[model samples]
Target chain A: MDRMLSADEIVRGLLAKEFSAAEVFRSSLERVRRMDPALSAMLSVTEEAGMAAARAVDECVARGEDPGPLAGVPVVLKDNMCYRAAPTTCGSRMLERWTPPYDAAVVTALEGAGAVILGKTNMDEFAMGGSTEYSAFGPASNPWDPDRVPGGSSGGSAVAVAAGYVPVALGSDTGGSIRQPASYCGVYGMKPTYGLVSRRGLVAFASSLDQIGPFARTAADLARMLSVIAAPDPGDGTSSRRARPEYGAAVASASLKGRKIAVVRELAGMKASLSPDVEGTLARVLDLCRREGAEIVEVSLPRSLEFGLPCYYILAPAEASSNLARFDGVRYGFSRKERTLKALYERTRGEGFGPEVKRRILTGTYVLSSGYYDAYYLTAQKVRQLMKEEFRKAFASCDLIALPTAPTPAFRKGELVDDPIQMYLADIFTLPVNLAGLPALSLNGGFTADARPLPVGVQLIAPQWGEEGLLSAAAVLERHLGPASVAPMAAVKGGDGR
Target chain B: MTVSERDVRHVAELARLHVEDDEIVGLVGHFTGIMAHFNALARAGEEGRLPLDDLSPVVFAHDEIPPLRADEVVESSVGRAVLDAAPDAREGFFVVPRIMEGDE
Candidate 1:
């Protein structure tokens, strides 16, 4: 039920008339049907919409017209991204019944570029948790091993790419939602600089930090996806108007000559234990960079790593408290009727939101409340400024910063769900990148020595608006290691339809 | 616990979420555990790991703001589209529980 082809190869075949768009999409669609029962990567499949889109691409090709750059590629959207007519529940009971009236800017751009929309994938409800285990739909399993989790809130998107169900999927990273999952699932995930990609219709978790980016098997495919969606939109006031870069051009030959890559001296002392395999993978990547003529420097980011998790927990939830105030049940999503308006809100929110989301919202309310605001919220905001300045100083000496995407590889599904602090601690490396509004990419680092191949990802963070450089460096690594391969899902793929 | 069960109830009330009696115990433990992490940030400041004397809070980075357009009126069908999803709407207004007290 599986067909092996790179996303780039699929586009090449379509353009060269070697195959129809329908043929390529059918392979993925059939694979999803056969394998999704075990993986639960997607929430809904837009089969009819996909067929119509595939046929349009065929028509464009037959009529001697140029299909846009992403022509005929099947991609998944994280459930929070709006697609008109599809139920964008954000894997929350709150939005379970609501269909967005319009498409997200990224969705419109994907459709405009002739990319086939596969379906929406599961996520932590309202993008609130690190594990997709918080998803109301059910957790998305790691394709590498079903008993383990695909690290999330964009876990399903990462799994969709890792399992070869689709070539590319879009994920939003607010404190490493995209990159951590990508690292765990062993695929390429990018959290573009804040304001680089339009977040017009993405359900806002933390308005300031949330950024939509791509997940792919190859650096080239990621570049292709980035090129299409990372354009300014009038709808998103924060979307940058900076001149666009040719992201694909940098991927072919990324010479790291004379590049000073900083390995954070501070994270070396982080209390969380790194698995042996991940430590080896990080060392391998640094060695490759050294061989490629890049100078590795040890840089200090005092107070940044130590305080980032707490600061993020403070700020993301604070913004989420205000932003999520819109979902009062009267406007669109699930609501209840009561004698008074307050009771309606109380019951609806109580019934609809999952535990993690409740914790965040409650914690957010606590921090932003009267006297405690100064201690928690005010202090976090000031520290956030210090963190930004810290990154600026670090970047003054290094072209890019490198770290492990997460402390460990994909873990067992139920392991950290009940342990909120432990779950938040796992996001240590990825959070500071978002806090500084810099661009970071997670690509295949290496694998564990176990019988099953567990993928580890190395992250390279570039200064704000430095995605091109990040991609170039990742391209160099990709060339050395080869692209991260598809997760071997033979057991699940060939399992009896249960 | 830094935040007690009573505090959890007050905060939940502020956030407009109705917590059942059974959830209070778990919520208290969760908040205390997370608050311990938040305290680390406080200690970082108090211990001078980094100076936090009077640095102005940065809501967003200064250089990253997008250019704003003139506030000219633009027509859109968004009003109709937005109203389409309301739980109950009549003549473009959302119908909700009665606002005035004693109206029930």
Candidate 2:
């Protein structure tokens, strides 16, 4: 209980009666209370409900029942996912007081697996920004350095794991929300292939792009967390009906022998943007792959690297504009009492949404408006298809493709907050995989050699439904790169508990 | 591509957002900057940089169609809970501002 325990260890210990489930939950809650004040990782801590769930697990164990794979494990969720017990705020004031009526598909899955729901974590308002700075509550500071921003919009979820509040946390990634923040925080985060995870009860951002995934300190924990939630749900039309493999078992004996890993050749052209730490980390990971009997090859993704940002900006916002139209002060959330419907919609949206959400909505509206649809939205879609083709061709000769999760390590908190475009560039390397709808995982490659050493991540992407390959490669890489370490709570510069 | 404040306001109105006049300057700058970057797709197509001339917009990433569940009715017990979460609800219907000025 003194240090962060992985979900696997917690489950085993719970079965062995090494510690009561209530004791484990209390210790994790204690850690959150102690560390999260400075990090601001969680938006709401569901102490009463979490303790109740832990007691239920303890009862099952006492009765000689299995209690399930994740019995007594502590887990946090991004605020976007609905849980009947907690307010589903999505880090926005609009839904600050809204409590979901039902649990998200993943939420139900985790509960069934005996994982205690710790709380909901903060994120960018409506999952639109790269930094949690867009959160209406306030930004979550990087655990490695309080002065630096945790890459987000899943910053809080990433911080929860990195600061040892929990071993596993769920986050939704529309672009690089999970991966970039995981990289910045030095944890393992994965964005499953689109449709592999159910989206039911998850607040829609860009319906097609948003995917709920997990953040964990070790590859095995990530695999276990994913195994529980990767099943199909009837509530979501886009959820895959295919059977999911046993992810934990797949990673347990994974080997990199004879696997072909590809490096993006086009990354050379963008060298000026890549930081030395990130570049060196990628090189070292590749060397590790080579030493593990894997071949490192090169593939070109010229269109994906150069045009993915523009393509994603257009398509994601176009969908977001449509998806967000539901928040018109009518059904739920914050509402303004206006005399007319138009006034109500305008005022509620203008006052309710943050600047980044408003900006994306306006951009989406512009691209999809009259006389502009074919030029921007349609053009971006074509480019997206072209990107898919590029990945398809690249994967024909490689089992996996590796890239830096972000162009650089975590930056100063306010550095790019004012520059929306500059902030978007932080996800440049991770976006193409999302655009292509391929499964990808970000593993902590190494850390920068500074006084406050920020972690850098190496991303591994696989073909559609190729999560096994991504996990297999990650499991092997984790063996060499070493599992990610939890940042000390004292590393935070000034603990004002902002 | 240049996006003026007028364009910004028009787009905001289309999206039903109330943009403050002072914020329009920043909105216009964001619109112009993002559009300039987005224009790269069109430019690449025109320059034949990628094979986009006859490419089709991808509806989904995979080739197989998503399997549909059997068409059947399932009882939902969350109706009352859903209604309870609404900002304003009368009976079972959501209460909203009147749509028509004369009808109200």
Could you say which candidate leads in DockQ?
A: 2
| lDDT values, one for every candidate | 0.89, 0.90
lDDT of 1 by residue, A1-498 (tens): 245677798889899999999988898899898779889999999998998999999999999999988899999999999998589999999999788888999999999998999999999999988879999989989888888889989999999998889989999999999999999999999999888899989999998789999999888999999999999888998888887887899887678999999998876676347887777898899999999999999889866787888999999999998888778878978888877888888898999898998989999999999988988898998999999999999999999999889999888889999888889888989999888888999988988877667889889999989988988988888888998788765634533323
Per-prediction interface RMSD in Å: 1.6, 1.6
How far does residue A442 in candidate 1 sit from its true spot (Å)?
A: 0.7
As for candidate 1, its clashing pairs are none
TM-scores, all models, native as reference: 0.97, 0.98
- In the range A1-498, model 2's lDDT, one tens digit per residue, is 686788889999989899998999999989888877788989999999999999999999999988988999999999999998989998888899999999999999999999999999989999998879999999999999988989899999999999888899999999999999999999999999999999999999998788999999888999999999999887988888889999987788899999999999989888999999999999999999999999999999988888999999999999999999988888879999988888889999999999999999999998999998988888888888988989999999999999999999999988998899999888898888888888999999989999778999989999999998888888888887778898975686354433
Model 1 residue runs over 4 Å out of place are A1-3, A491-498, B46-49
* Collision pairs in model 2: none
* Candidate 2 per-residue C-alpha lDDT over B1-104 given as tens digits, one digit per residue, 9 for 90 to 100: 68988899898889999988888888888888898888877787778886777889888866557777899998999998888988899989898877766443
Task: Please tell me what DockQ candidate 1 reaches.
Answer: 0.71
